[model samples]
Target: MRKVSRDRGYHHGDLRASLITASFELLAEVGLRRFSVAAVARRLGVSSAAPYRHFPGRDHLLSAVSAAAAHDLRSAIVAAADRAGADPSSRLASVAEAYFRYVVRTGAGFHVIYAAELYAVPDEARREQTRALMATLLELASAVGVPSHRQAVALVEAIVAVAHGYTTLFAEGFFAQGALTVDATAARAVAAAEALIRAAGDR
Candidate 1:
């Protein structure tokens, strides 16, 4: 896509959307340590000052980016859960697998969204996105006869923790020495989630 030049005078109809798309690309390419408004502007082919027109500062831009990422992750989890039939174990497995796939697809940007420093709880939309993700997991746990709300919550926490840890390790190449196919790796995460849910039911 032809990026707007600094001299182009913002002819595009949606400058904010353009900046966000550029920001995601730049972050994925360089990661959080080197992220800056200037890099985003460069990706958009605009002057360094161009992003400030929409974002005020890097934090605001990052907040928006992180919020978008969180929303996408929630959607993926919900969709996968819905598609995995009525079995709670299958739903949990599908959601866990979806999460791992998302990590593989988004990597550093995925970490950025989940980072508490960037995605503050004060952001209502992001907060709701997080709640929705938990609600889906909790619903699945309840379906599996986890016995009580508190137990279901604990089961969900374990599921998310294990899935996140696996994704982080996998993305960082901790498992690079293993000849693991994406399906096999996702299966491992799914199995962990199922085991946690089943153990909760047993207990």
Candidate 2:
């Protein structure tokens, strides 16, 4: 029931981009359930239907946001791999650390992309984007000698799951009661992940 603006200048200056940005902001503030097209229009100073010109509906907007987030994550993993130098093992470790860091730093966006139930239905386009993002990590795993393509994919998936689970627990203050700092915990987790990957390779 939010009010929409009657302004006419919204068409110029990347209205679609503006609406997407506003939608992400609202998503971070209130999450998916409370987010609405009317609310986004209110935030963007446009008529409620204006967004429909670009996004068919709220689901489309959510999908766009999820795609953007997936792209960002893919870029981050690539950068982390590059920063880890030419060593495959180092690259794998760096990717795990980077993935964890991304989830923690971009918690809201990460939640929307991975945890939001709005995208429960399999959208081919979104799935493709997510697959590409995961492929980067799998490629890194392969480079690190994960035995085979299937093994590489499995290793990357396991590492990512561990990192994500630990990060979620960390965010919930699971380790705050301990004497370790967040950085220390993350380092330990990354090290453990590296060891696990190496062991898997040996097997």
Candidate 3:
């Protein structure tokens, strides 16, 4: 990723996309609470007031940042599933691993996307990304022999819930800092997701 010169003006190029990119990095660096439109503008070498033209306010800008996270998460899960071999349950479980790794790699983005209430009232574009991820999850769930849409949805939610639990514990250092490495924690999440998927089949 090219680091944009902070000395450049907002009108130099595609400011809208630039702002989103900068905002995502800022979210990763600072956090949701400290994130502001002005901070992102400063990172991009734009006037604090300049970002208002593209983003109505901080919430709108954060919406774009979370949407970028969705894009990253969706791609990561799909790639992980592809590499998990022919076993449907394994492939589905790998998605959970991808999520665990994603949280570890970008904690702030995860918190902003999930813990920040973004899902409660997602913008239309964000909703589209959520649907796309749901579609991917459903596809993997179907592969696990999940028969009904209702069951598939439940299974997806359960896997994510369990992954969230594990990630929250490990990433936040609830366990002693050295007790569980990121990959070790991710492996546990994968096992939990697999167990959930297998249990779904038994039900």
Candidate 4:
């Protein structure tokens, strides 16, 4: 039998990225419960112990993947905020829409990141990255004139909860039976979030 090398080739420059990609595929197929470092290595056609060379265990791999997803989501939100221009209402709508789209596109991965059970002991760096992403959204809320900074954070959190909840429901096909398309549901949710923002500004 040929010797199974963990590093594959000499340089493992792309090992981390490859592992993360494999992790996402595994998540989409078997979900977070069945996810494992050995599975990821197997998916990547590497030695079963290959992943352990980089990831301490399954939790470390999950945290790394979740952190990457969070970064992508944060970037998407920032881009949407930029595209919304200087209009407060437009900015708020853009942020909500962006968040919804992200959830739709990254359902399984997002679930892993947000699901409490899967990430009960998230890496410290991943936790900080997640917080920074929330902070970015809160800053956008403040930019839209959400009164005080504290209120901005609260408003953003509320909006996130609504968007995330709606996305989860939609993914489970709840609105499909109600004659509502994803776009339509997203629009309604964004409109409702905008109304809340306006109401907060009024108070």
Best of the candidates, TM-score = 3
Best by lDDT: 3
Model 3 / residue 71 / CA error / Å: 1.9
The TM-scores of all predictions, comma-separated, are: 0.80, 0.74, 0.82, 0.78
Q: Candidate 4 residues 11-86, lDDT tens each?
A: 3577777888667666655667788888877766778887888888777888887887778788888888788788
Residue lDDT tens for model 3, 1-203? 22345564545558988888777667656666788899888887778898888778887887876777777788888999989999999999998899888766665334676545565554998777767877898899888888899999899889988887887787456867568777788888998998898899999
Return the candidate ranking by TM-score, descending.
3, 1, 4, 2
* Candidate with better lDDT, 1 vs 3: 3
Worst 10 residues of 3 by lDDT: 1-10
Q: Model 4 off-target regions past 4 Å?
A: 1-13, 28-30, 108-111, 114-128, 178-181
Candidate 4 achieves a global lDDT of: 0.74
Clashes of each: 0, 0, 0, 0
lDDT of 2 by residue, 60-176 (tens): 777776777787778887888798788888788876677677666555334567655545655777778777887787788888776688898788877887777777777677888
Ranking by lDDT: 3, 4, 2, 1
Indicate the worst ten consecutive residues by lDDT in candidate 2. Answer: 1-10
Count of backbone collisions in candidate 3: 0
lDDT digits (tens) for residues 1-203 of candidate 1: 12445453454668787777676666655667788888888776778997888887887887777777777777788788888988877887676788787766654334577665654435676667656766766787788876689987777777777877887777667878996777888889998888776677667
**What's the true lDDT of residue 44 in model 3?**
79
**Residue pairs with backbone atoms closer than 3 Å in model 2 (clashes):** none
Give the poorly placed runs of model 1, Cα more than 4 Å off. Answer: 1-11, 108-111, 118-122
**Segments of candidate 2 deviating more than 4 angstroms:** 1-11, 26-49, 108-128, 179-182
